[model samples]
Target: MQKPEPMKDQVPWATIGLVLLWYGTNIGVLLLNKYLLSNYGFKYPVFLTMCHMTACSLLSYAAIAFMKVVPMQSIKSKRQFLKISALSAVFCFSVVLGNVSLRFLPVSFNQAIGATTPFFTAVFAYLMSNKREAWLTYATLVPVVAGVIIASRSEPSFHLFGFIMCVSATAARAFKSVLQGILLSSEGEKLNSMNLLMYMAPIAVVILLPATLLMEENVIGNTIALARNDIKIVWYLLFNSSLAYFVNLTNFLVTKRTSALTLQVLGNAKGAVAVVVSILIFKNPVSIIGMIGYLFTVMGVVLYSEAKKRYG
Candidate 1:
């Protein structure tokens, strides 16, 4: 028999669609979060995050069960459930803190702080697992840290508490990512991103409920009062929560279709798009130095992604 030629790779329209969908949902949720927390007078971050997790839990179930988007996964053991609950706790902490920070910080400056996630990730990896990256990879983080410093100094609406919360949220997010890998590294314990979300969402809701009740005084009463005043608040919560689920779904779909490096690069671009959109929509004042600093951080993120891809 004659040897056959291999087929060439075609343009990934599906992946492209997924990436665009991811961006839309991600940015939509971010903008809505800012609007709800800052402008809309919904100051309960834990409650807002609870709404998101509740939506995720319900949507994930429907997608897996009725829509058949992916095979349904169940917790195999108590240990696995515990691990997922731990992750959910961390996830809730990061999300609640991020939302809280949004109340006091402009989305652009917040995103600038968030762009330094890789720096935290690298640090956590080394501290937790003694993992070391190439020198170049570490060097790329210099600009990442420096940019935040410059932006913080120049930000017109800088709030120290918001900055601290954002940085802590970023660190907690990095820690969760690292912890997930450690907790689920074994083949038997591993779950796909969808399944992970499915499991984590409900647990996160459980974790957030008590915290919301304890930490946010009269949140339920306030929400009810707000709804009585403006029924649109309910609609906003519904829409924002739905967007939250889609954000996770599209993110997993995009990563599944493309390389993680591609997702990271796309994320860098997404942050810039978000910053621009938020600036236009919220009309938040941004100094020239602040913009320059954000650009530097984004550039550093891109370089870090490239360096990680090459070195790893």
Candidate 2:
């Protein structure tokens, strides 16, 4: 008798465990990033992102080289490569924006707002796939928006520019999620999430280099100078960046192994963890409204997750 064909959409229990681990690892990444930025400065965040991406890119390159899995010749079309590269670049930008926000905002608030990515992603997915969404999904939007407003109360330096940037950053992140889902669904190649991430760093560096030079204090020269004076900062940046990538890669794997639903449930802890880290490390002030906001945000995430499970 022939073996039964594996169901592509079936989720496994091991993936559930992985998703939980991903949540824990992400919390660690948040702690490290918040600690570094609040204690140090933007230079730390910049260096961390650049260096971490460099390391991950190198590791990914090494793996591909050893397996002799050079960009699959079939998918080596310039147009395809450019498309993937563009997606990766956008991801990198979203990441950098989040990092920059960490410098000014509390981790809890940042992540609380960031969590809205799923909602935006749902909308994008609906638009991209041209599928109609269920009423339940739309219903959850009210809580999600309210939660964002609540969480915004604790923002350390809430300016119009910063608020706009943070919102844009969250939306961009949502876009990345939608794009990745589309890519992974359509692409037939052996492209793992890590592979996608590995391609991102180099492309991101290329895209952000000009901005770093013009907007950042002194770019490479300043970073180099700072590194020379404080080697600890280098280590901090390296560790934070590396951990962040690892967390993300782990998340993708976990979601693949388990159902996205499991990860969503487990990921609800990120905001609380982020909040504690911000309070303890940064001594960020929180008002009654902010606490309410956090609860609402968490509720929105839960509601959104359930809606997807039912309607997705």
Candidate 3:
């Protein structure tokens, strides 16, 4: 008898464990960063991002050299370096803008706004690929974008700068996903996720250092205050950095092992989880319309993913 074909979306228990790890660590980093920047009063998103990049760079190197967690892949030429540099810049912008928005908005509001990422992703995917999606797919994003607009207008803690940065970050994230996939698939220049991270993290360091210096002031003074207030902030920041690494790692692992839609579904679920946990932890005031809009946005993500699964 012939063996049955393997299911593309079948997820083993091990993969589920990684998904849970991804969820926990993601929430941990968001909450920890918010605490440090807001209540803990660190107030340096660029500097904080620079630190995470530095940590990930050093740790990525160590993993390759010492632990052999990922085999090393040399950047073969300047063209490859330039490609990696561009990817790194887009990645940096997405993350740093996210970190910056925390200073001006509550975590719940930030995440509700963030749930509209699929809208941006859909828009960029069409523009770059020039592939027209099914009108049903396009219709799915309408509510997602509308919901975010409603939430933004209704959020009690909304700041114009934060709102703008968050929206831009969402678009950058969407663009990066599309561009990174294209860049990695280039002829004779494929890199696995870990190798990509290894190369990209250093470029991020170079890019972020100048931005941090230009955008933030009195880092040394703030560091002293943060440390003196609670040395535990330092410890949590280290943990946050480490989680950032694992988040990237598990993301790659999840994609390689499961169906494409699995990750996107989990991504939508993560946005919902982040919004709920943010509300509980931060106790931020959200208007009724904002809650309604948040739910609409999340539902739109689910419907959009399902629509793609069926038709796209």
Candidate 4:
């Protein structure tokens, strides 16, 4: 009998489809967020973020409980609930600041600043866990930081406060990722991303409610007024909030289907695609230096991913 031939790996169409869906939801939510905050005069980032959390809370519950998409995990202890609350608080901060930055900065420029997340992630990992990356991995971040500085100077519509908000938001996001690992490192405490969101969203909504009411001036009344003038604003909020949940869902799905490193690589490309698409949609002006800087930052991110893959 002839020896059987070894089978070659086939294309993963299901994973590819999920990736495309991930890209669509991620970029769609981002563009819509920019539109609502800047062009549509929402003017209430905190409240908008609250709405997103509320939607996530409802949608995630339905997905887990009714749809039976994933096994629901319960909080085993008060300590775990507290950890989830802390993560939720951090999440609220990152999201609201991101929306506020979008109100002042062009989407393209905002994405450029957000690309520096890897630099912040590395810093937080070291500070929080005393963990260190290889020297080459650290070296990869230099261009990431430098590219943002170059882009900041060259950006046609640079806003100082916006830049600060964007950077702070990025840092907060990275901090949350690191803190999540530290807080939920144990096998018993570890929750899948979906269950984590399911538990965290309601806590985030609770946290945001008082902050939104206190920080924003007459946000509810103004939103009602806006909706009265154009009922489409109601529809827009519904759609935008729904997209926000989908963004989280798709992100979890993509990471489940592919490795985390693949997700990071896809994320770098997603940011670049978002930048190009936003510039075209919003007709934002970009200088050659700005484009070069954005590209340079993206290249650094790619190198950082590769370095992590190899060094780890």
Candidate 5:
């Protein structure tokens, strides 16, 4: 008898475990990030982002070169490395801006803003790939945009700085997705997430360190000394980096076992879960209109994902 296909015929227990791992880690990272950024008064987003990129680069190198968790696939030439560098530029901004946003906004509100990423994804895909969506798909963006507008208006603790940074981060993330598809459509250029992480994370470090130096007042050395003195800060920072790696790893695992659309759907669901958990943990004062608006945006994303599955 022929072996069953792994993607189509997943072992039920294994799939369930992976789903739980992905969900738990994704939520855990967000909360921890919020705590470190705002609640704990460790307000150095650029440096924190630098740390994450540094850890990601080191961990990814080990996975590709030493652990052999994924077969190593290095970029072939200068042109290819340049493309990866461009991708890294956007990714670095996305993460740093995202961390910056968490410093001012409640996590619930932040995730509500993030739920609009599919709207930006639709826009970026058209510009980058010249790939147009169906009229219905275009129409679906109305609710996503409108919901966010309403949610932002009613968010109890709205901060203009956080709002702007969150929106920028969402747009940057969408751009990264579209650009990666356009840049790596070739079979030879394709790298699994770990290998991609190995290359992109280091490039991001190169792009971010200068920005951290220019924008952040605290030197990297000073920050490290401070974190070392605080035992809890040290562990949280380390755990955060480890959690970041698991995030990328599980994203690859889920997409391989299931489909990209399934992962997208799960991402939407995760955003919703994160929002609810944030409200509970932070006791954020969300109004009824704000709640309704968030629900609308999330539902719109679900619809958008389904439409993409069919028409995209």
Candidate 6:
């Protein structure tokens, strides 16, 4: 008897575990950063981005060095290198914008807006894929938009600028996800996660460093000083980067195993978890109506994911 062919979309339990870890740990990192930034008067998002990217780069390079996957000189194709570099810029930009938004918006507010990433991803995929959504998906789109509106209104007093910034950041993040999907599909022919990560890491650091220096100014030096004075910052930086990278890997693996829509919707638990943590810890002011709005947002995400699975 011939052996059955392996399923391409069937990820192992171990892989699933990684994806969940990615989602939960990502939420944890956000909570920790919010706490630290709030309690210690630290400029977090920017500082953390620089530290995390630098550390991830170093660790990723060390792994490549140990495994002998690609020597320093093996990136011979200028086109591929440029493409990864561009992707790195986009990813880093989104992260920076997100961190900036966190400075003004509560953690839950940022998470709620960020949850709309799937909607934007769906829109971009539909546009880029040239595929028409079914009537059900179109119907579900209404509730999803409505849910976001509801959640956005829950804030104490919305700053037009901050709201716009948060929405822009969310859209940038969505764009990054779509672009990553495209780039991964293309360069995946030649690059593994570690290689892509190793290559992109330096590019991100190079691009982000000058931007941080110009915009954040003295905040950068102060953060570095804090990092040295408190060894805990070092641990936080390591855990933040390593866990985030690992989680993203799991997200990628799970997408191969399951439907993107399923992952998007189910992964929304991150927003809910973040919202609760923010409120309990930071006391983010949320009215009853706003809480109701969050519930609707969660429900909409679930419904949207289910619809996509059926029709997609």
The best candidate by TM-score is 4
lDDT, candidate 4, 1-312, per-residue tens: 999999999999999999999999999999999999999888899999999999999999999999988898999999999999999999999999999999999999999999999999999999999999999999999999999999999999999999999999999999999999999999999999999999999999999999999999899999999889999999999999999999999999899888899999999999999998998999988999999999889999999999999998
The clash numbers for all candidates, in the given order, read: 0, 2, 0, 0, 0, 1
Candidate 6, residue 281: CA error in Å? 2.0
Per-residue alpha-carbon lDDT of candidate 3 for residues 1-312, written as tens digits (9 for 90 to 100): 999998797657898898898888888888988888887777889888888898889888888778887678889889888989999999999999999888888888888878888788877777888767899999999889888888877888889998898888888988998887777676579888788899899899999888987888878677878789789878877887888887777787788878679988888888888888988888888799999988889899999998888896
Global lDDT for candidate 4? 0.94
* Model 2 TM-score (2 dp): 0.82
Candidate 1 residues 236-298, lDDT tens each? 999999999999889888888887888898999999999999999999999999999998899
Candidate 1 vs candidate 4, TM-score winner: 4
lDDT order, best first, reads 1, 4, 5, 3, 6, 2
lDDT of 5 by residue, 51-78 (tens): 8898889988887788887788878988
Kindly report which residue stretches of model 6 are placed more than 4 angstroms away from their true locations once superposed.
1-20, 63-76, 126-129, 157-159, 183-194, 224-235, 250-262
Give the least accurate 10-residue stretch of model 3, judged by summed lDDT. Answer: 179-188
Q: Candidate 5, which segments miss by more than 4 Å at Cα?
A: 1-11, 221-225
lDDT, candidate 3, residue 156? 87
Instruction: List candidate 3 segments past 4 Å from native.
Output: 1-12
TM-score order of candidates, top first: 4, 1, 5, 3, 2, 6
Residues 233-285 of candidate 2 have per-residue lDDT tens digits of 67876776667666866776767766667767767775677677667776776
lDDT of 5 at 93: 91
- 2 against 5, candidate with superior TM-score: 5
Clashing pairs in 2: 15-257, 15-258
Q: Give the per-residue lDDT of model 6 (tens digit) for 132-208.
A: 77878767666666776887776784556657777888787777767767765653345655677778888888987
Clashing residue pairs in candidate 1 (N, C-alpha, C atoms within 3 angstroms): none
Which of candidates 2 and 6 reaches a greater TM-score?
2
Runs off by more than 4 Å, candidate 2: 1-21, 44-47, 63-74, 126-129, 153-159, 183-190
